[model samples]
Target: MTNFFDQFMSPTYLGVPLMALALTLPWVLYPTPSSRWLNNRLLTLQAWFINRFTQQLLLPLNTGGHKWAVMFTSLMLFLLTINLMGLLPYTFTPTTQLSLNMGLAVPLWLATVIIGMRNQPTIALGHLLPEGTPPLLVPILIIIETISLFIRPLALGVRLTANLTAGHLLIQLIATAVFVLMSTMPTVAIITATVLFLLTLLEVAVAMIQAYVFVLLLSLYLQENV
Candidate 1:
């Protein structure tokens, strides 16, 4: 009961709700309906440069849809903020949980499926099992395709959750080590502190990298299926 109550009311639970609010607040404050600058030239040029950079850095993740590309970039930004928040001494990283990552990943996979179906309803399922497949292999191919479809979101969730959890656990272990060393050797503690700080910087990089990886994979899946 204690564990259940704590899980329900913990900062980890609240943080995700707050993050969703944060994501939507900007739209509310700037209200696109009243905006005169939705397609400003400067913004377009900026997006162009950013897209070009992402194309080079995330070669495999790139899909041809401009709208999907923009959304993918935004998702990366949001995930990066949430992941890096854990490094702030007192904050929690919600993405470290498989459930939270699943929340993001499942929607992405669903969107790909729904949109792909709508865009090409007559052949969406057919695309998965491909034509010219052996008559005897049709049933096998269908099952394989179904499993592959399910694995898309599963892989996405596992990758993000594992990376974020490992990074946070590593930071915690290093901090514990530093504290232990401080008791027996002052110089060792100082060295450990420096190393820990360096690792914290690396964690920030990992946060950004993982976010990119998630978004990139999402885009790739959408492109292939849609």
Candidate 2:
């Protein structure tokens, strides 16, 4: 029997070639931007979503942080597209890979920390030791806070990976059950297939939400720094 987990593994052609096609597929599907009096519905809807999301995300941030508007918006869209695409038949989710997730999380998280340290060193270090820390417990609290700070990126990566992996595994299990029962118990199989369809819908929501949460948390982190 094929291992259900095997689907999560990264596949390659000719020695693990970069999944360039999968990465670029979403961009290719997007309607091109046009300069005209009026635009198509798809382009208009895309513009509205981008505008709304950018406004909401930057609302809490200061004017200086507004510089990141483009980066954050692009990141959100990229993650959302990649995640939704993964749900298609025979497609692989690159976000399910810890390496890829960490590659995203660590640099962004580190950049926030760097900005905090460079721009507002006092306030940033102040986060390490809370106000009115007891004299005797200061060392312990500082060490704990430092550890927590470092753990943020790991948490980000693991949360995305675990959620995607769990949802996909559950869908696969239910699907396999449906297939197995079809030959002998057509009625039960039909019911199972219905449940599977519902689960797939739920997974679609999950994929979108996880991508949002990932970007949201990064924004919060950026807010702290800038």
User: In terms of TM-score, which candidate is strongest?
Assistant: 2
Where is the poorest 10-residue window by lDDT in model 1?
Answer: 1-10
* lDDT, candidate 1, 10-35, per-residue tens: 35354455545434443443213224
lDDT of 1 at 221: 70
Clashes of each: 0, 0
List clashing residue pairs in candidate 1: none
Report lDDT per candidate: 0.72, 0.90
Model 1 residue 199 distance off true place after TM-score fit, in angstroms: 2.3
lDDT score at residue 86, model 2, on the 0-100 scale: 90
Error of 1 at 22 (Å): 7.4
Q: In model 2, which residue pairs have backbone atoms overlapping below 3 Å? A: none
Candidate 2, poorest ten consecutive residues by summed lDDT? 16-25
State TM-scores per candidate.
Answer: 0.70, 0.95
